[model samples]
Each structure stands twice: as structure tokens, then as C-alpha cells.
Target chain A: MYITWMLAEGHTYKQMLPTTPGVFMGEMIVVTVVGADKPGIVAAISSVLAEAKANIVDISMTVLRGFFSMIMVVDISGAVTDLTDLRDRLERKGDEVGVKVMVLHEDVFRYMQKI
Target chain B: MTKYDASELAEIIEMLSFQHLDIRAVTMGINITGALRYDDLGEGVREIVEKHARGLRDAVKEVSSKLGVQIVTKRVAVTPVSVLLDAKAGDLNEAVRLGVSVAEALDSAAADLGVDYVGGYAAFVESGYSLGDRGVMESIPEALSSTERVTAMVNAASTLSGINMDAVYEMGSIVKETANLTGGRGCTRLGVFANAPEGTPFVPGAYHGRGEEDPVINVAVSGPGVIENVVRSLEDADLRTLHDAMKRAAFKVTRLGELVGREVANRLGVKFGSVDLSLAPSPAVGDSVADVLRAMGVEEPGAPGSVLALAVLTDAVKKGGAMATSSVGGLSGAFIPVSEDLGMAEAVRKGSLTLSSLEAMAAVCSTGLDMIVLPGDVEEHVIAAIIGDVMALGIVLDKSLGVRLIPVPGAREGDEVDFGGLLGKAPVMPVGRFSSKALVMRGGVVPPTVSRLMKG
Candidate 1:
């Protein structure tokens, strides 16, 4: 743990550890990938998020007869990139990989499914 | 512990992105009854703008951002202005001027607050027009045409009051005059209703009724595509199984409404009014009530089994929605607006859905003749007769119904016109070029039916 100072406006100012540049942070979001069944779909999706410094917390993928479907819960709080930027970049990557990608905040899932 | 798991998350994402699950509108109904007590109209308008406009845009933005679900429309429904104009004389010129001025004030306030539509520039005359009702009625055309955001309605009939043919006849000409003024666009802002409710969040039919004494939040839920997808998946579902499937789907949709609506109201410090579980459609392919009807065995929306399918769909939705939330009001059924629903538009293009068929469908569903564009040459009296026929249906069956017909200028039958955006693109449907001049000319109030007398 690093020393942190509390500011008047309720924001934290943290001093960095000697070796690490960015602190470990997480923001849970659901990502859905759907397209024709093919190889390298997972790698194609993960590479874009990974390049943006997003962490894949959980993932599931399956092929239904011919079409492929993948769902991932990722943490992007550690990324320097904004959520909107990462979403657009991932969508562009999906277009190249011949799949449809959708990224939504995890609250949508929690609100709809549980209660 | 968090509420949803992996499977539920995937399902929600699919419905949201592809199946068109969304919150249609969060209409905040504010009571402007006290405004009438003020001597000056400007003072009244000032008080209203002050009370309602503050922190509205910020509240909506904050709630929408916090929830992550899009609150697509923000609207305000004020108490009917006709009540305020009642103390004045029924002079037509004065009425129009007052209408335009009041509308300008409301429109400016709404624009300032970043609200989309300001409803309840309306008058109710189910039996006969009061002096103020007459004043507001005569000014509706000028009022609606002059304002950008203010929408209005006239309840020409109700279950107890029966059909007011006199008011219906007047509205027909008002509709025609409004269409002329705005090139068939202003009519979109007007709604003529039978048995209109006080809590409908959707416009132009929404108004803060006399029954409501305080501010309230009404939520209109959207998701025809999700139910359509579910119905399509169950290819072999019988009527019983289909009903069950729809109930289950509606339950989920309305639950989302309840959750989001209550949170929004709580954040805004207003009372949570109701979750109107209407499967409202937009121009998008997947977000169509007609598509849901198609999935329920109707090859076309106005075909033989269309009414039955609509009945089943409407009943199942009401049941599910009622169970999901304690307070459910408004037109809580599937909307069959031609331009708004892609499937319905296609049905019109294929020549399967006719104007008469739409009237028949409206008898079972929520609104009548909504977003249907007619040829430019259609007679004004014929338009009134169309409304008259629908009003008659409402009187007999005792259900809420309305008409939002647009007689496009210079457009003939089968010629497509694009209003663009959520108003969508629509092909002009034929209105048969018939004249109802004599019927409209002899307009007297249609007396209450035997059903009205039977209420013991």
C-alpha cells in the first residue's frame, strides 16, 4: 500500500510505489461478441482491450452449430484510455475480425437479471 | 452480493444492443392548477417555469449516467391550460392570441430546461364545451402550429360521457388546418382521444389530469424486439404457451422499468407514479410491435388473425406489467403506429394493412390511426369521420383510443415520405377520397349509450 492524502474536495492524492507507474484498479463491464464460427476470435477481441490496458476478469465462448458467441467481463479502470475510446476501438477491431462487438456497463446486467 | 450472473448479463446485453430494450420516456407531470389563481397570465407562466425547470436537465443526466440505461426522452406534462382560460370569454381571436402566448412561454421554458416535449396544452369536452373549452378548442390549430415543443389533446368522448360528435367534428377541421399550417407536420403534435387517462407519459396524449394534485414521475418502457425474438424462438408455441412466453418477457421488461423509474424518481425527489408497459416501436428493425404480431402467427399486421394476436399480446403485457409494478397507468399496450414500426410500414407497402383494418386493430389495442399518412387530396370531413368512427368504438367498448393522422402535402397513395429520425419514414396509405360532408355538417353531440346508463 502507498501513502495517500485526502483532499478537501473528497478526492484522493496517492503517492506512487517506487517501481510501479500505475496502481491496480478495476471497472467491471460486459462485452458480447457474435459472428460466424472461426479461429482467433478470442485473440482478436482480447488483443484490442489488452492493448488499451484492460484486464479480462472472466470470459466464456461457444459455437452454436456454425455461429460463434462470446461473453466477457473485463476491468478497464487501470487503462489510461477512456471507456468510450476503448469501445470505439474494440468495435473497429470487431469489424476487421468479421464479428459484432458490444460493450456495456455491468450495472445493466445486474439491474435486468437479478431483481 | 451483486444481482446478475454471466448468463443474465449476456441476455441483457443482447436485448439492449440487438433486441431494443430501452426506457422510452421519463415524463415528469407537474401540477399547474395553482397558476389559475394568479391574475396575470405572465405571472402564472413565470411561477410554472420557476417551479418546474430548475435542475431538471441535470437530474435527468445524472440519473441516466448513474443507471447506464438510456432515458431516451425527457418531457413535462402540466395541468391542462383550458382550466386556466375558463374564466375568460370565448372570443376566437383572444383565444388564439392567448394560445400562442401561453404556448410560447411553455415552449421557451421547456427548451431552457432541455426537455423534449411539453404536453397538456389541451382541453377536455366529452359532453359539451364549456366557455373556456370553446376558447381553447378554437385556438388549438394556431397554438400547436406556432409552438415547437407544446403538444395538445382533446378528449371528445369517454365511457360515461359518450361520443361528442360536435367536438369531434371541430377537431377534424383543426387537424386539417394544423396540417395546412405546418405541411402535415403540426398534426403530429395533436392527439384526439376517447377515454384518455391522466398519467400517460407518451405524447401528444399525455396530460396532468385533474385527479392528480402533485408532481409525479411516469415511466414508459420499451422492448418490442425482445418479445418478438422470444416469440420467434418458440416456433411451435400454442396460444397458451405464447401467452406464457409474452407474460414472462413483459415481466422482465416492466421490472427494468420499475427499477429504473423508481431510481429516477428517487434521485429527482419526486413520487414514482407508474410503469406504462407499452411495447412502443421506433423505425429500427428489431424494435417493432408489428414484428411481435408477426411472430405471433399474423402473416401481416392487419390480416385475419391480427386482432386476436393483438388481444393476446395486450392482455399478457398488462398482466405481467401489473404484477411487476404496483402502479401501472397510461396506455399499457402495444402501439401500432405505421411510420414508427418498420414491420407495419412494410405491411402497408405490401398492401395488406388498410386504414379500415387499422381502425379495427385500434379497437382492440391502445391508439387509433397513429402516424398514418394519407394522400394530400383526402377530404377534411373524411378525416373527421375516421376519428368519429374510432370514437364510436371507444364509447361502445369503453377503452382509451386516439388518432394522429397526417395528410401529407403533394404526396399520393404509395408515395413514401421520410419524416426522418424516430418519426420514421412512411408510405402514404389510401383514404379512398370519400367525402363525409353531410355527416360532419349535422354534428350534434352523440348521447350516452345504454352501457353508460347500466352503471348502478
Candidate 2:
């Protein structure tokens, strides 16, 4: 266990509860990564999800000049690991690989009114 | 126990850990009013009890198991018990009994299905009043308190008839009383409507109108963050460019709604309703409709300059939404629902906006008269006047429009009501010091007399 103090509320903090049984299992969600282009980026991240035993439902990649971006929607209900830990690992891996990765909850994406 | 173990679970977890999606809600509509007997209103209610449980029983159980997704909300929508009065006007006793009947049916349905709520105990008096309307309205406070999962609405006024001030006066107090009913739970389940559209899919408010037989489906597509991101990405985009971007964004978003809706219908075995391609904004961060307009260059969203901003955005949004879905029907366009939207409410609270500016926006947007909060003590005639403005717009444009106004008790203009959460906080916007007695006093039914549109 860790005890820590942090600066607060002006920033929105969303607390994700454990997805209920029979609801979130095998759920699918889309993720996107955008940042300066670098080598071995896709391999580094895909391998992380692969190691976590997540299913890659769909994926697309593009190299926008000096920056590289990729969008992937994955199903991870059957994953061998906890989702929170996987998220932490991905953030660290992103730091390692030089590309910023952001995960989006699919249903949240749906409810959001597009401009 | 952990919901899943390794093997398929771990890999799936890893992939979804950084993945994205949300499930808005799962709603069920059950009709219970018919269960009331010709004279035995109570047993007629008992029949409704059996019907909703038996009819929807297998559907809910089967869908939940197969979808492998927990249904977010299990609700019921029933025939408006308010209509019970047409034949039983003298039966205030029966009206009260009927309301109790429907409430018990809702209670039993929720208990049976383990669903949170049921809807469609509603009254639609768009143009004129019926004795049943009055009876139902009178009993709603009692009905709301007595029921579980039984949500209700009264379409007290509409765009065509201007507005019924008497209905306004009654509803104003009724909602206040209803909110106090059952420790505020009733407030969560109730909605008061004006210029209500005929067939909307979501509720506490959805009803299968008597005139509609097709089981029409209308999809409410939402994605404020997506649109905000799109608009944000276009920093220097001109209005034309903005429209183009939104159109492209809408096309992409509509494709998503179409996919899910068709799948839901396929599984449920129902005909598809029109996908309402409304950019219904919510209170989530970065998911604001007003932010898009602000991003469009109206830094102060409620200022005089913003009216033009709204006009341009409303028109451009329609242009995009029309291009996205062929079945762009229902109240389609951007929703400026104050209580439901984060940015608009914030703008009002900060004095960046006013009711006048909101009404101006509605003139060109989809929801002609929408979720605006007026101050308490504003006369019924003033409310009627606003409704008149909305109805005029609807008649002139030949579109479906509605209003969901809340007059918070004891709140005045420049004061704010904290609804908390996604209902957001509302700033009581100013309604002009004016009256429409002359216009409203001349109240006759505005017949369905669209000469050219009817010709087609």
C-alpha cells in the first residue's frame, strides 16, 4: 500500500469502478496513440497487449510526417491480467517508446456529441 | 472472486486496459394501463401487472444472457393513465385508483426483472385539454410518489397551439410537489414536456403514440468529445470548413449509430426506427456542444455576439447531420438542453447567456423549444408566450420540436439551481417582462394545415 498527497479538483478526475460481471467481460474498447514518430513503436506496444493476452479486434496506423498515430479497438474480456495494471504498463511503455498512448472507453465515445 | 481468470481473461484485459467504449443505458417500455378493467380500475391495473411481467420476462432474461452484457437499466413505458379520465371524469376515485394500479404494475415489473425503472405512464395534451388530462395531471403527484419505476410526462403545450397557461400553472406546481414526493426519487423519474415529438426511443418520457403503428425506431446518437476533438483539430477552419469537418464527423458518427441500432433491432426482432443523429451534448469533460461553438469563435457563449455564433453553428450542424444519415428524422440537430448540457449551463451561471439568446438559437436548431429553466413566480402567461414563440417556429418550418422547462421553486433570474451530476447546474435565465394574452386568448386549434407539405 502507498500513501500519497496530490494537488486537487480543478482537473476532472474520473474514477472507473470495476466493470460488473457478465457486463464488462470480453468488452471491446478503442485506443489511439499520437506523438513524434519513433522506431519499434508498434512492436513495443502490441507486444505489451499480446503479453497481457488481449484480443486485437481492429487496428490502423499512419505516419503523419514526423509524427505517427495509430488507432486500435481491442477486446480484452479474456485477458490474463488486470486492466488497471495493463493501463499503467502501457503508459510506462509509451514513455519508453516515445509515443503518447491514450485509451478511450467505447461507450463514452458513443455518448459524446461530436462537434 | 475476480470476474475472470488468466488465459482468455488476461489477454483480453490487456487489450481493453487501454481501450475505449461506454454503454449509455438499457431501457424497457411496458404498457400497463390497459390492464385496468372497464370498471374495475384496480384489477385492470392487476392485468397490467401480469402483462408486463409475463410479456417482457423472457425478453429481458434472454437478452442479458446472450448479449453477455449487463443491461444498464430495465424500465417500463405504459399507456398514459391520464387518459383514463376521458370515460371516468367523475371518477376522481378511479383516476387515483388507476394511477395506483399503474404504479403497482411498475413496482412489480421492476421487482420481477431486477430492472431499476419503467416508463410510459404519460399524458400527451399538445393542442388542447381533456378531462382525462386534468384528472391525470391532478393525480400525478400521488401517482409519482406511489409508484416504483413508473415514470410520467404531460405534453401540456406545443408549438402549434402556442401554450396552455393553465397547464403551465398546474405543471409548475405539480412538478414541484412531485419532486418532493417519495424523498426526491420521483423527481428523477419525471419529465414535463412541451411541443413533444411523437416517438422518441429513450425515456422516462417515451410513448408509443396512438397515431403511430409502425413501431418506428429513432436512434439518439451522441459523441460530444468526438465533435469537440474534430472542431479543436481545426484551429483556423472557416465556417464553411467547419461545416465540412462537422459533416465528415457526422457521417463517421452516424455510421457508428447505424451499426449498433441495426444490431439491437436484429437481436430484438423489431423494425428499425430513424436514427435521430442529434449531437445531444452531455456534462462530461471535453464533451460540450457549446465548446464547439466557442471553438467556432464565440469566446463568451452567452454574449450578444453569440446569437450569430449560435445561428451559424445551428445551421452548419444541420447541414452536417443531414449529410450523415438518410433517416435524419425525429428532433434532429444539436440539443441545447440546459439541464442536460454542461457548457450551456455554465455559460448561463456565469452570465454569458440568457433565455433570449437560447430561444434565438432554438429558432434554427432541432429542439424548437427545449430544456430551459425559468424563474419561479413568472406568470403562466409568460410561459405561454414563450411556448407561442416556439409553436410559431415549428409551424413555419414544418418540424418536430419540444420544450422541457423547469421553474425551480423559489429561484429567481440570476440565481442558480444545483441539480448535481449530468443534469448539471442551471442558471435561472431571464424571461422577458411581456404578456401574450391577446395571442393566447385567440386560442383555436391550429389545424394540420400545411398546404404544400401535405400535398406531397
Candidate 3:
């Protein structure tokens, strides 16, 4: 039940990273969220994704140690702007809500895989 | 005669085609010796099983979670319980009691840790036997009938030890009886083998091998979703393009698994086993090995569904894993654990799938007759035949595969084994009612054939 709440609150995601070395066909992005419990965490972040023209492919969310943790898989093939701008905007919102948000290129996963 | 047949000079024209996966589990080793801890005369066996199950659950979760992927199962295969229960083997009732305790401990541990399936309740007697081995094998019917989570395996022969004809003869009857007693779950819970490995992490076939120490870290990676996505992504791409795409994704999946695995191993301080990038499936709405097939534009996953899919998927995964790390092994193909897969389970529940259908899937999969939930009270001889069929395939194909049949207690046709979490809960399927007792009883030795030498 609380899992529902954390998911509802913002979550983490991978923005479609630009297809670079060690990456697959599509642009991939990963987003991660860690913070004190709150509501609409996902709604808030997904709204940002909507603004950035990304599609969600997979998602996982949970609450641990009274902190909300979530991971989102997104496609930025259709994004209107680069993720850096989006990352800046998300950090601003996260700071306002006292939530910690991180936006990573999907290559981070690719980078991780190479090791 | 055509050169292809007579002279054998015709080059084998191979074409890369469909790319999809159906099987999701490649658990190769599960040590069951936890039940034999004799510090207090085996008083700590249950605790050990509990610890083993919990540790596996925790480790599987820690690694999978770190990778941002949903692991389909957190299973453990242990050493056979019979060798350790020699003192208690004579009493079937006592053997059953211990089996029940271990099952309960596993279930309880999984429940507490919020992980899924915990296996490793078995006995192996491929060559000689012990009092405990006989006891555990005898109690299989009752033990399997009573447990919701436990899995079992019996090795009657192997390359190391010549086939135990006597043990094979008895096992045939026992398999059928277990099927009958458990209403057929035993058909899926039971597995017989010639040369079973020591570190298998999957079940119905997992038993402690001599090399296993305490418990070690092993990772089974499933990417049917990834595979399916790749197949769809390359619909218009040529075979080379499709294979390339698969290789690229497989590389990422395996890399992610390696990263997570190394971390878990470092934390546990145990040597890490291979990263099995088996395209495992889930029972979720859209997750299935069959779904993978459908994505390849094949309406069904059957004979003539294109035999090349297996080789293609295998090659792609190997390339990816190779780039990820130098160390890799285990049943690293597509998994098709029947009851554990949502699509197959649902198909069985709907009556569109059958045992032969499973066998067809097994031909190209990592293992055969996996986690198949069957009706209770199935005949044991039938179970023996199922095991024999898979064992024969293993010998003939020279590939590693085993059966993990579950004879759900109190279950009948249409009943479900609700083992929530990674095992995903599956409905029981029906098997042939006729007994294979005569054939099983005639078991001399399934002499190892040259097929067993397949290095692939």
C-alpha cells in the first residue's frame, strides 16, 4: 500500500540516453528518486517527462527507511530539448519539495554493463 | 545422391531468423545439505535451510534491485537431503517430517525477506545409496504433497558413477507413486539425471554438489522482455541487423547483471558464479517466452516455429556476455519453466498447452520440464517417463536441462499453486494418467550415449 504512495510521489527514471558507445538502438534515460515520503512524486516527475517528450517503458518504485525510491525507464527519442535542461528543471523542483532527484543517461546503464 | 546427403560436401546454409525467448529460469545449483547439519544431530538443519533461503532471497534482490530490473525468481537449489539423513532414512514418516520443516523454513524465510521462490529440498542417488537417500526418496510423495514451496530432485545415474540400475528401478515406481500421491505435482517436482552439475541455481534439479561451500553467489538474468523488444525493434531489419540488435541489448543486460553480481559477491565475500543471461519469462500480463515468439511474428512457439531461434538467441547472448566478462557459464539460454511462466501457466490453465508442447519448447531451451505444476495424485511411473524423456534429451542433445515438477498438495486439475513473488504463482496442468511403471521398473542403466559429449 505504501508502495503505491511512493510511486505516486515522484520516482527515478532513465532519460533516453543518446545512442552512444555501449548503448542500444534507442535513446535511453534513467531517473532515480530518493527522499522523505511525499505524494504525487511520480505525477510530478512524469509531468516533467511529458514536457520533455519522453515515453516511459518500465518503472519500479518502493519506500525504504521512510524514503521513497523509484526507477523509471524512459525513451527520449522524441524529446524537444536535451536532458540537461530537463535535469536542471527537475533539480529545482526536487529542491523545492525536499526530494532528491537524479537524471541519468541510459548510457550510465551501458557504462555499468561494460564493467 | 545429392552432394548434400551423399558426399556431405554441401555447405550447410544457415540463416539467422526470429529472435525471441520463452524460458526465464536457469537456476543450476541449489545445495540441500542445510538440512543435514549435524552439530546438534541435524537440529540446525531447519535453521540452515531457513538461512540459506533467506540469504538467496536477499542476494537475488540486492543484485536485481541495483540493476533496475525485475528478477523473476529468487530460487535456491541445495544438496540432496538423503545423504545427510542416513540415520533417519529408515523412517519415511521422519523423513517427511524433516522435509516439511525445511519447506516451511524456506517459505517462512521468503515471506520474511519479501523475496520469491526458495528451492533445495531433494536427494541424489545416481550410483549407490544411503539410508537417508532411501528415506528421503520414499517420503517424496508425502513431502511434495504437503509443501507449497519446496522442490525435489533424484539423480539415479551419472558419468562419474555408473548408473545404479537398482536405484533406477525403484525410482521409476517412486516417481509414479509420488505423482499419484501429490495428484501429479510430483511430475514437475521430480527430476532424474545421468550427469547433474554441482552448482545449479535453479530447481527441481538443484542439489548440493561436492564443490559447493556453505552458500555462494550466483546470478540468473532474464531478458525475454528485452529479447521481445529487440525482435520487434528489428522487424524490418535483416537477420544481421536483428542479430546485431540482440547482441547489443544482450551486452547491456549482461553488463548490468555483472555489475550487480560483482557488488553482491564483494559484499558477501563469496566467489561469484556465472551471470546466466537466460531469457526468463514472468507470469505477468504481457511477459512470456511465447510472447517473445509472437513478437517475432510467429503465432505459436512450436515445431516449425523456426528452429533457428534457439541458435540465434544463444549466439547473441553469448556474444553479449562475452563482452561483459570473461567468466560465464550455466544454462544460459532461454528458460521455459512451465508453471513459473505466466503465459504458459495461463495457457495450461486455458487448455491450449500440453506436455508435448512443453517438450517442443524444451528442445531449444536451456532446460527441460522445468517448474511444471501438476495435479496432485499423479501416477509415479508417468513422472518417471517425464524425467526419462528429459534425461534422454539432455544425453542426446548434449545440452544441460532438467525437470522441476511440483505435485501441489491438495491440488487437483485446475488448482493453482499460489507461491507469490518471483515464482509468480501458477495453475496446475494435467499429465497422462496411465502409469509408466513397467518401463520404469525395467530400468537397468540408461547407458551414457555419445550425445553426452556435446560441448555446446
Candidate 4:
């Protein structure tokens, strides 16, 4: 069963997992967006992920000193596409929205941040 | 919960985008000992290397794309070519011919496999030379000159076995001969080592030693720019604070290597070897190790406090890297190769980084006197003395060190020569006019250090 969630900003992964246990069982990718604050940034990025059927397990966004930053934890195991194609789509979407988007496997953050 | 803040994510992004942080090399160590069983040595070696290195580049690319981290180079390291020559070579001429043929095969296979460099044209003769060792020593110049993408190393000293001055003396002439043969480019592909590590991923020294897995993936991580950025951000911070910051940065950088190495190995179905903690620098502006020293308040790389600064940096990197991965096996320290580092080359041109100071720094750093260019007419014995000095340090201090000296043909002191691409460019530094011929000529072996006899 493919499930997609648009969790509220600042919602932690732990908070969402219990609500829909085993629904987030997929390869998690970290998508970071950074650029000047602008309207509709979230809509544009979410559209691209929606087309690929990737689930947004968690998201956090903030604007500091006129610069916008957002981190999206996505589950791509149920997506129809691989990481490379998803990255290409997200990058093209980034170009359209004037933000620098980076799509990285969640393991990079886990390995570096944890131990 | 694995919690990560916005700042941590931002830091990783900045490192990848601006700090030039990347896995420097993913070298696959292939055991080629079985090649000697075949009648045709060169063909046997070619088939083995081809079979092992077939999918290495694709594997690296796939992992790099999946992780979104840049992998700069992919390489292969095979068993020492000298091992095959041991059974095949009947004399010096036969050794030279066989070595060149094998080197050509390695080069062709590397090109076909899309590998950057193929290492392990090597001989280990710390105490003395075997017939094959002598043959390899004699064949180095011709082998290096005849082949591109083939790197060679000779281990002439070790803590337990002492220094082999005979091979050291011969290597001097080999460097000169290679310089004359390849217009000094071949010398860049050769190194003389003391305590050369078995699983080093760095070229000119990487070789698959005995007891290693059939084919293993060993990663060398590059992060001088990352460390330099850390030091810069901590403006006016105390040395201890700066060290802590650099160590944290190293932890993250090494984690990247570990992730990339494991993924690449998993995809290739090979064992993951080790992540060399060495902060390998490139010719890029911000990526230089000298710049890292300068960022840490050293006026120039060879200035008075340079050694102390380098010591702190090397120690911090080792500490942080050791914590990050249990598999740390190569020359796990900082590298300050002159030509390959923009700031180090600039320091030489400014007359601030002298060869003498580089040797002193080598005592505390990884490798020794790397990619240093000398005047063409410099005597062979003087080169021998330079190598002997570093060899002594490696033995006495019981560390891994190596020398890659290039005596460029028709080039004089202060004259700049470019070796293109990753080899970079450098000015021909002046050597002592006084001869060390007398000392190097009276060579047999420097006895093992007293530390070797100490109770374990």
C-alpha cells in the first residue's frame, strides 16, 4: 500500500510514525531547500514530489535574515522513480523556484550526525 | 530519534558546495599473485586486473549519484609487479622488459576500466634486495617512462628491518633516468617509501599487500578546504577550541567517506577496506593544505611554527577520524604535496617553504617531500641523501613516509614547469650544492632502530 503524508511543519518523525505505523517504511531522503524568502516555494517542491509519489514524512521550514531554509524528510521506497531521477526533477524544480535544492540519502545525515 | 537541526544540514550543504569536501579516491585493491601461474606474465596480469576492475567506475558513479556527494577519482591497486618478476626475470634486462610489458598492460586496463591510476609496481627491500627486488629497482625508470597511468613505489626502509641504502642509492639514478626519459613527468609516478602501508589508497604508494581480501575498496578522503573553513570560522578562537572544531569537521568529512566507501563496496560486491584519514589536498585554490596551515595562524607553511601547527592538525584529524571509522589503515595523516597543492606551490615560489622545512614537517605529517621539483643537474647522490633523511625519520619515529622528487630535465632552480591536470605545477627548488655522494656511496644498510628491540 502506497501512503503519502503532508505533515505540518516542525512535526518530528517520531510524532508521525505512531499515527501511521509501518506506512513510512521506505528509503528516507533528506531534501534541503535554501534561498531568499519567496512565496509558493513549498507548493512548487511538493508538486514535483507528488508527481513522483514520494511521501513527505516530516518537514521543517524557517526564514532568517531574509533567507529561507527548509528541510524535508521524504520516503522514496514507494516512488515510481529512483534517486537520480528524483534528484534531477527536484533540481529542475529548484531552478524554477530560485532555490538551491539538495537531495541526499538520509543515511548521510544519520551516519555523520549520530556517530 | 535521530535528530538533526537546520544548522547541521546547512553545514553539510556548505561543505559539499563550497568547501570542496569529497572522497578523493576510491581505490580497489586487487590481488594479482595468481597471475604468476600463467605462462605469459603480462597477459595474466591484464586478465586479472580487467576482471577485478571491470565495474569499479560504474559502481563509484552510481554510489556518488545516490549519495549526492562528489567522488573525485576512482583507482585500482594490484599486487606488487615485482612479485611476478620474481619468478619470471632471469636478469636485469629481462626484468626491465617484463616490467615494461606488465606496466603497459596495467595502463591499458586502467584506461579501459576508466580508473584514474593503477598502483603496485613496487618492490619491498627494507633490509636487502632479492633478485626480483633488484630487478624491479633497475626497471623502474623504463617501466614508468614506457607507460602512462602506472605508478610505482619501492619500500626501502622500515622500523623493524632498517634502511636499505643500496636501493636508496640506486633509486637516485632511477629518478634521474626517469626524468630524462619522460621529461620529468615519469618521476611524478614514482615514490621511494619507508614503512609503506599495505592498503593505502593514495597513488604511487597504494598496493594490495598479502592477507588483504581478494578485491577490497579503500577510500581516501579529502577535506583540507573543509578544515580550513572550520579554522576560518573560529576567528580568534583559542588553539584548543580551533582543534575541537577541526576535529568535528573531520568527523563529518570522514563519515562521508565511510558512507561512500561502504555503498560503493556493497554495490560492487567487494569488501570495504578502510577510509584513509589523510587530508589530501588538490591543486584548487581553497583546497590546499598550506592554506589550512595559514588559516590556523601559520604565517606560511615553512615558517617557524609550521611544524607545531601541522602537528596539531594531523593529531586532531587522526583523533576525529579514528572515532568515525574503525577501519583506518592507510597513511592516516595530512599530506602537503607541493605541486598538487596551490598554496604549497605558492609558498615555494615565495621562498618561504624550503625543502629542509618540508623534511621537518614530514616528521609529523603523512608522507615526505612529495612532488618537489629540483634542478635537472642536481646530483643523484643528493637525491639519495634527501630520501635517506626521510627514511631515517620514518624508522626512528616509526611512521610511514615516502619521497617523490622530480629532477626536471633542462629546468633550473626557480623555473616553473607544469605537469598538467592533477599533478599540477611547481618551481624547481634549489638543492644543496655540496655533495652527499660520500655518505650515500658508503651505503650498505642503516641498522634497525633500538625501538625495535624493546619489549612488547
Best by lDDT: 4
Q: At residue B417, what lDDT does model 3 achieve?
A: 81
Off by over 4 Å in 4: A1-25, A61-67
Give each model's clash number.
Answer: 0, 51, 77, 0
Measured against the true structure, the TM-scores of the candidates, in listed sequence, are 0.85, 0.69, 0.67, 0.94
Full-model lDDT, candidate 2: 0.57
Model 3, C-alpha of A12: deviation from truth (Å): 23
Q: Give the per-residue lDDT digits (tens) of candidate 3, residues B365-448.
A: 776767777666666566667777776666566666666666665687777786655556777777875666777777666666
- Interface-residue RMSD per candidate? 6.0, 13.1, 20.0, 3.7
RMSD of each: 6.5, 10.5, 12.0, 3.3
Name the top DockQ candidate. Answer: 4
Docking class of 1: incorrect
| Cα distance off (Å), candidate 1, residue A34 | 6.2
Would you list the clashing residue pairs of candidate 4?
A: none
**DockQ of the two-chain complex in candidate 2:** 0.05
lDDT for residue A42 in candidate 2, whole number 0-100: 67
Residue B281's lDDT in candidate 4: 93
For residues B256-353, write the lDDT of model 2, one tens digit per residue: 45544454555556555555566666566566777877877788666766666666666665666666556554455677777667788788777777
In model 3, the runs with Cα more than 4 Å from the true position are A1-115, B1-39, B46-77, B87-117, B145-148, B157-194, B345-353, B371-378, B406-438, B451-456
By lDDT, highest first, what's the ranking? 4, 1, 3, 2
Model 4 residue B210 lDDT score: 95
